[model samples]
Target: MKDSLELRTVTVTRYITPLREGGSLPALAEADDDFKYVLKFRGAGHGVKALIAELLGGLIARELGLKVPELVFAELDEAFGRTEADEEIQDLLQFSKGLNLALHFLSGALTFDPAAETVDDTLASKIVWLDAFITNVDRTFRNTNMLIWHKELWLIDHGAAFYFHHSFSNWEKSAETPFSFIKDHVLLPRASKLYEVDQEFKKILNRDKFVAIVDQIPTEWLEWEGSDFSANEIREVYLNFLLRRLESSTIFINEANKWRDASI
Candidate 1:
C-alpha cells in the first residue's frame, strides 16, 4: 500500500446533529481531535459503496489538486449512539458501530452558487472530467455538492458516483459506458478544456495511486458482496475500470462540448 493510504483516524466524541439535507441522513459530529466532521455512516441505506465513493473520490480530487475536505477513518463505538433519542438515528448509529467515514468539517464555509459566481475554467474542466470518469450523476445544478472557503472551492458528498458496484455483472463494460448524464453537470459549461485536462491526468495519475486509494478502504466493506471475487480482486476491478475510462475519455469530452453548445 502506498503511504497515502495512511488516513488519520478519529473517534466520534459527540453526535451534534443530523444533517437531513441528504437522504442518507449524515450527521455533524465532533471527534476526539476537537475537530468536527460530516460522518458518512457505513450502515446507511446507501451501504458501504457510498463510503467507498467518499474516500476514493476525495483521494482522486486531492491528487488532481482540487480542494476536497480532509477525509479520515471514523471509529464509531456502539455505546456512543445509545443516548440518541431519535429512533432513526439510533438505528444508523447501531449499524455504524464499526468503521465509518468522515469529511473534515469546514466551519463558516459558504455554499457554491453557480448563478452568482464564475468558476475558473481549468478547475471546472478538471472537476467535470472527474465526475464523468466516475459516472457521478449527483452534481447537478440544483445540488452542486460543493462549498467555498477562503476563496477556493471544496468538493463534498461523492457517494452517488461509482454506481457500478451495486451489481458487478457488467463491471468491465462499465468503463466504456458513456457518461451521458454529465451534460447536466453544474460545471460542464465552464469546462472547455476537458481534452487538455485528460492529457495532464494521464501523465500524473498511475495505477499505484489508484491501488493506494482502494487500500485505504476497510476490508469488511469490500468483502461483503461478490461471492466469487475476494476483496483484493474487487479492488483490482475498480482500478481497471477507472483506467479504461481514462483511455476513452475523449468520447465524453465530445459529449460535453455538444452539451455546452446546446445549453446556450
Candidate 2:
C-alpha cells in the first residue's frame, strides 16, 4: 500500500451500466470533483463478493511478478443508482473507436490489445497460469477480466473464480487435484519463450512472501457483505494451495540445477 493514496467517501454522480447484455453488475462512476473510476458493485442478489475476489486475486498476481493494474480501496454511497446513459460507457462496450473516450483506453495510459498479443502478453500468460494454480477460474475466454495498462496486464473482476457457491464446483474439484504448471500457458513454448524473468519471478513466488502480500489487502475490502468467508479463511485456502504447488515447483527447479551441474 502506498502512503500517498487516500480513500474518501463520495456520492456516486451516476452509475454507468454494464456494457454487456448479461452477467454481474458493472458500473462507471464519476466523482463530484470529476475524478472518474469504474465501480463494480453487487447486483440485486450478489453482494460485494466480486470486489473481494478481485482485490485478493490482484494482490496475489502482483506478488507473483505478474504485471497488473494499480488497485485501491474505493468507497461510494450505497444509494447511487445505475444507468446506461453515459456516452463513454456506450463506446467502450461497443469497442467503437469511441473506445478512446475511456480513461485507460486513452493513449499512453496502457498498452494492451485484446485482439493481438503484445510484449506484455508473455507475463499476462503467466498471470493466467498463476490464476489457474490458485483455482482462479474467472479469467476465462468470455470474460477475460484483465486489462493492459502501462505495458502490463492487470487482473480484475475475479468474483467468478472459485465460484463453487454459484454452481461451479468443477473448478474447485480440479484445484484440489494435482497442481500442474506444465499445463500453464506461461510454461508453454510460445509464452515465457526466453524465461528471462526466472530470477525476478522466483524471488517473490514463495508461500511466505505470498501470504505477506495478501496481508496488505485492506480488511474492509475483503469483508464484503456478499461474502460469507473471512479473510483468514481465504488466506488459509490459498496458503495451503500454494504449499502444494510450491512443493512441486521446488523439485522442478532443483532438477534443473542438477542438470546444469550446479549446487542443489
Candidate 3:
C-alpha cells in the first residue's frame, strides 16, 4: 500500500465528456499518463469543500479495506478548455485552472443494482459503517454511488461526505452526533454484523493515520472564500474532527444497529 500522504499528480490531456449524473459536473478526461480519470472540478457547484470531502472520504474508505479508485491530483493548464463549446463547461474549466481531484476511471463498470445484486453481511456491514462514519448522505437506495467492476464492488463519488465543513459552526458537536440517515442505506437490510465489524474496523484506523490523510489536502483548497480559519488551522480542524468521530464511533454504530434492527 502506498503511503497515506502520497497521491500521484497528473495533467489533463483531453476532456472526453461530462458526467452529468450529479450536480457537480465531473468529466471523463484523459491525463498525460495515458490513463482516463473522472475529474472532479474544484469550481463545481459544491466548490472546494466537495473536493476536500471527496479526498477524505475516499482515502478513509481505502484505509478501512474498501476498494476505492485511485485518487490523483489532476492539473489543468490555463489554456486547457478554452475551446470548449459549452459556455458553462468553459467557465468551469477557466475557474478550475489549478489542482483538482480525479479518480481512476473504471472502464465498462456498471452501477450497482440492489434488486439484481447481493452483498454479504460482512461487506454490507462494513460499508454501512463507513458511510455512517463519514456522514455521507448520498449512498441511499436512490443513488448507490457504487460500481461493479471486475466482479468486485468499487466505491465512488464521495463529494457529499463531511458536509459539516460546508458550514463549520459546531463541527465538533456534529462529529459526535449519530448519523440517523443510515436507515435509508441500500445495504442496511443486509448489515446484520454491524456490531461485529465495528470492533474490527475500529482497529484499522487511528489519529496518526487521520493526520496523514488530512495532510494530503492541498493548501489552496483550505483557503476558501469567507473562511475565518487559516489553511493550517483548517487542517487542524479536519484532524480534530476525524479523531473525535473515531472516539465516538459507538454512537454511530449503535444508531446503525437501531435502524437495521427496526428495518427487519
Highest lDDT model number = 3
Candidate 2 lDDT over 3-43, as tens digits, reads 32222344445444453423543555564556565554433
lDDT ranking from best to worst?
3, 1, 2
32 Cα displacement, candidate 2 (Å)? 5.8
Residue 262 of model 2, lDDT score: 28
Q: Which lDDT values do the candidates have, in the order given?
A: 0.87, 0.46, 0.93
Q: What tens digits encode model 1's per-residue C-alpha lDDT throughout 1-264? A: 537557898999999999998679999999999999999999997788899988888888888888889999999997988978999999999999888999988999988999988998998999998898888888989999999888889999889988888787687778877778988899998998888898998887888878777778788888775378888888888888877877888887888878987987
lDDT of 2 at 255: 31
Pairs in steric clash, model 1: none
Q: The CA-based lDDT of model 1 is what?
A: 0.87
Candidate 3 runs further than 4 Å off: 1-4
Estimate TM-scores for all models.
Answer: 0.96, 0.58, 0.98
Alpha carbon RMSD to native, model 2:
8.6
lDDT of 2: 0.46
- Stretches of model 2 off by over 4 angstroms after superposition: 1-13, 32-34, 44-46, 82-115, 118-125, 138-143, 146-155, 164-189, 192-200, 216-231, 248-264
Question: How displaced is residue 139 in candidate 1, in Å?
Answer: 0.8
- In candidate 3 the C-alpha lDDT for residue 85 amounts to 100
* Number of backbone clashes in candidate 1: 0
Which candidate gets the maximum TM-score versus the true structure?
3
